[model samples]
Target: SAEGEELLRKLPGYLAQPGVTALVFNFVDQLIHGRSEHAILHEVARDASALRSLTRTWFEESALMRALREAERRSVPVLLTTDHGSIHCNTPATVFAKRDATANLRYKFGEDLRAERPDTALLVDDLPSWGLPQMHLGVRLLLALSDHFFVYPTKLREYQGRYRGAFLHGGVTPEEMIVPVALLTPRSAG
Candidate 1:
């Protein structure tokens, strides 16, 4: 982590060097910690506000910010984008499977699958029209949820307690998918 931070710190210098044309800042789904469900639900949910707080803090302190600031100072162009988004699951969708099943709130993987709500965009059963090749349910759910994922009720308390103080974004909902793209140029020194 320290090394990561150090690398981040050097980003500004890296971009400031020369021959760099454009920089794209794509803060994708749960830009903070989508990799860890437990971390997303537990640590980030503890806070009352949205998880973007953590991202804000990162931008303030991380090398990414430093790089962007340098680019701004130099009058370089920057573009920000996200491939998809995520959602916080307030309603639990029960997925039944045998023991030794892999469990993820956003999606699940197992045999003999069943869900509490049939409305779920089943990957194996649905989404072929979207041109995505057939994959496991988890992968399908992941794609379908694109900016709107699941949040289980079983971990609601834990999520409320732990993730109360972080930033997260993903889900089909507007908040996650509908982000802004900005172009910044340095103010004239005149």
Candidate 2:
């Protein structure tokens, strides 16, 4: 807490000395980790509205916004983005993956990963089209569609229960693939 404040205090000096200074904020990431396997998992997990409320409240009151306000006061530019979008997963698609498979919930990257055609999608033969590099020869990406998530056949019930109703990404959907990018310039600057 105080450490972050100290960083902010030193920010202008850092900006003045160097060619470029980059300040990256991950407010939503902290909220995501707070909700899952980090903090009180049950609170937001049980009540869906808790996620929305927490997000809105944090955006309005968090120091990340305060830092941005300070930047705006100094007439600095603010650009906002998210690493990836997530969707509330419902359906489960059975896939076969090796032990060393890339263990993402919505996608699997491994050899011989298979799922039903209607249930999931398999992208092999090429990765450049998607801008994803294949890990190795014959390596492929198996992606879940719609609200579906990839679950290994082993311990199927356990994995399904663990991921059901959770927000996740790695596959394709309008919400997951499409992201909003905004460059914030204060009206005073204009």
Candidate 3:
């Protein structure tokens, strides 16, 4: 809780130290809150405009922004990226099972389950080719769905409730897999 802020305050000193050549900021799942996770998935699935706003808000006020600013002040080389992206799920294909059911908009899980068109959704069955640059794909997919930070389609309702409404980002897609890396340094040095 408070430790996050405390740690953030000390980051500048940590980066300013000598011998710290490169600083890589990995901000994937932390960008989205637990309550608004599914919102992104719904928005991405049907609305392009919403996605743009979501993306802007994510980069602007997220932890990534805090770290980026600190790194820039210290003139440290920074690379920003993710593991994967997620797809919005509208059609809730029936997944058969005995236990509780998860509430992820992009993906779901249970004991014994099946989907009419599993291919349309990004699941374990489509990891090889669909999952590329592992990191980016993971982040994008998770952020698009629900939060809970990193909740795979394993546990049923418990995890679902924890993540439902939050934004997530892992999975295999262009939005999640293909991320840009920007290098920021002092103007004088540049």
Candidate 4:
């Protein structure tokens, strides 16, 4: 713990670097690993209240508070945002795709991607129209809808056992699509 605190103490200096237009720190790993797994396996609450409690503890214990304190002391502006949010996916939708298809639990993009349960996924054949760059011809995107994750029939049971109730993004659900963005001005600057 002392080592961790020592590492975090350097955050202020890192943020104060000269000519640095912006600096970013990624704490998503802390959010992702073991959060849903523990919640699902231990039958803890998986609702927003639980998330708020967990994140509250994390912010208090982690470097976020220190970062905020440094920013305020230096009168720096802070921008908080997430590329996407995650959802607790319960259902596994069987999908068939080429061997080289990208293997994300929540979505897949490749040629000839098809879900056995069509209702569980939203098929987007027009990648360009969706603001996704077309890597090649026939590069369709399949986004698992609601709380479903794409799984291969060959390893359906294994995937279900491992990923059931896991929090994942890259889907077509509101939880994944609607993310938060906040611009914070330090009180001294404000």
Best by lDDT: 4
Q: What TM-score would candidate 4 get against the native? A: 0.81
Q: What Cα-based lDDT does every candidate model obtain? A: 0.51, 0.72, 0.47, 0.78
* Clash count for each candidate, listed in order shown: 29, 0, 36, 0
TM value for model 3: 0.49
Query: Candidate 1 on 15-123: residue-level lDDT in tens?
Result: 6677754444544344546434465444554443545575676568765677666667766666655555555444434455454445554454445555555565344
- The deviation in Å at residue 14 for candidate 4 is 4.7
- Which of the two, 1 or 3, has more TM-score? 1
The TM-score-based order of candidates, best leading, equals: 2, 4, 1, 3
Give the poorly placed runs of model 2, Cα more than 4 Å off: 14-21, 45-48
Candidate 3 residue-wise lDDT, 149-187, digit = tens: 223345445555544443344434565467766556656
What range of 10 consecutive residues in model 2 has the weakest lDDT sum? 33-42
lDDT of 3 at 188: 50
What local lDDT does model 1 show for residue 171? 30
lDDT of 4 at 175: 88
Candidate 2 per-residue C-alpha lDDT over 145-187 given as tens digits, one digit per residue, 9 for 90 to 100: 8888887777789978777777777788877888888888877
Q: How close is every model to the real structure, measured as TM-score?
A: 0.56, 0.85, 0.49, 0.81
- Candidate 4 Cα deviation (angstroms), residue 38: 7.7
